[model samples]
Target chain A: GAGVSQSPSNKVTEKGKDVELRCDPISGHTALYWYRQSLGQGLEFLIYFQGNSAPDKSGLPSDRFSAERTGGSVSTLTIQRTQQEDSAVYLCASSFSSHSEEQYFGPGTRLTVT
Target chain B: AQTVTQSQPEMSVQEAETVTLSCTYDTSENNYYLFWYKQPPSRQMILVIRQEAYKQQNATENRFSVNFQKAAKSFSLKISDSQLGDTAMYFCAFMKHNTNDMRFGAGTRLTVKP
Candidate 1:
């Protein structure tokens, strides 16, 4: 089976530019998650989507960060006016459901704001 | 909010030996799940092991196992017969039974030297 996959393995953007990271969850996974991993730090939760329910954005650090899951499968995390602090590995994960035992993570998209 | 702590920033173990990575968490919730994930240099996160809070017995998977101390709010991962491939960043994560997100601790970078 194909694992979760992300595009543009590496992206370098200007401080004020906008960047979008895409995630394709496993074929039938209904629970999707987005997290940020700062250098030498733990992963910080970003957003989550479960089936047809509303996405959870409580973990978004600021209004500049937002995400959307369309057709209950693919998700996109969009960062507007990126900052140097936003330079980190953005990881995407998915599971069978919110209650599933484990999450499958992608290779992660490393974004460097220059 | 629940908080997970991995005090050890880094560790190294000889290949074919045993090594343990410690994790402690603080949470008011009784029913939850704990997980250990391995992230290699490629940035792919893989589930190494998991333990359920209600289960009194610990969980083991092949060369990987967990030491779950419910009362102490501790979950440690032990790798037996460590291999060079086992070198990676180990993360401890916690999630309420049906929560929308899992909180991760600052990862512990483990190096297996031959």
Candidate 2:
């Protein structure tokens, strides 16, 4: 079975430019989440989507950060007007459902805002 | 709000020896799940082990196991006969029973040397 996968493993962009990171969750996974890992820091919750229910957006650090899951399988995290502080590893994870304890994670996309 | 803590920033263990990584979390929810995830230099987050808060017995997977203290809010991971491949950044995570929101602690960097 295929595990979660992400595209553009490394991305370098200008500070003010917008970047979109993609995630392909494991087939049959209905719960998807996005998290940020900064240097010397823990993973910070970003956003989550469960099936077709409304996504949890509370974890978004600011209005510039947003994410969307399309057709309940693929997700994209878009950062608008990125800042140097946004330079970090973007990790995506998915679970069988919201109640599933073990979530499968993908190889993260490292974004560097230059 | 839930929070996970890993006090040890780094640890080293000799190959074939045993090592323990401590983790503590603060949460009001009575039922939840605790997880240990390993992230190597490849940036892929892998689930090492998991424990259900409602279960009294600890969970074990091969040489990896957990010491889950539900009352004390502590969940420690123990690795026996540690191998060089076990060297990685280990993170402790918390997730309430029925939600997609999960929290992670600042990781502990483990080095297994021969």
Candidate 3:
């Protein structure tokens, strides 16, 4: 079975531009999550969606960061007015459900803001 | 709020030797899950092992095992007979029962030297 997949494996953008990163969770997965990994650091939680309930946006660093999951499967994370500090690897993951402990991760999309 | 901690930033072990990565988390919830994930330069997060809070027995996957001390809020991963392919960043994560929110710790980079 195909694991989670992220599009535009690498993205380079201007500091002030907006960028959208896409994630395709495994088929039938009802839980999706986004995380940011800075160089030489740990994974930072961003946001997550489960079923039809409202997504958990508490981990989002700022208003510039937002995500949306459509049809309970695909998710997109958008960083508006990106800053140099936004440079990092953005990873997406999915589980069988919210109760499932193990999450399958995608080969992240590295975003570089210059 | 809960937080995960990884005390070791970097470590090394000879091939075919054994090494353990320490992880501690602080949480008030009684039910949760602990996980160990490995990420190499390829940037894909792989689930190494997982332990449920309610389980007294440690979780093991072949050469990978965990020392889960629920009372102490500790979850350490032990890799026996380490191989070169085991060289990567190991991340410890926590998720509350039935919740999709997962917290991660600062990773420990393990270098398997021949």
Candidate lDDT (C-alpha), each: 0.94, 0.93, 0.94
Across residues A1-114, which tens digit of lDDT does each residue of candidate 2 receive? 489999899999999999999999999989998999998788998998999999989889999998988999999999999999999999999988887458899999999999
Candidate 1 lDDT by residue in tens digits, A1-114? 499999889999999999999999998999999999999889999998999999888889999999999999889999999999999999999998787358999999999999
Docking class of 3: medium
Model 2 misses residue A63 by how many Å? 1.2
Kindly report the docking quality category of candidate 1.
Answer: high
TM-score for the A-chain in each candidate structure: 0.97, 0.97, 0.97
Candidate 1 deviates by what RMSD? 1.0
A best-first ranking of the candidates according to their TM-score comes to 1, 2, 3
Model 1 global lDDT (CA atoms, 0 to 1) = 0.94
Across B1-114, the per-residue lDDT of candidate 3 in tens digits comes to 889999999999999999999999999999999999999989999999988889999999999999999889999999999999999999999999987778899999999999
* Backbone clash tally (model 3): 0
The candidate with the higher TM-score, 1 or 2, is: 1
Q: Candidate 2 chain B: worst 10 consecutive residues by lDDT? A: B94-103
Misplaced by over 4 Å in model 3 are none
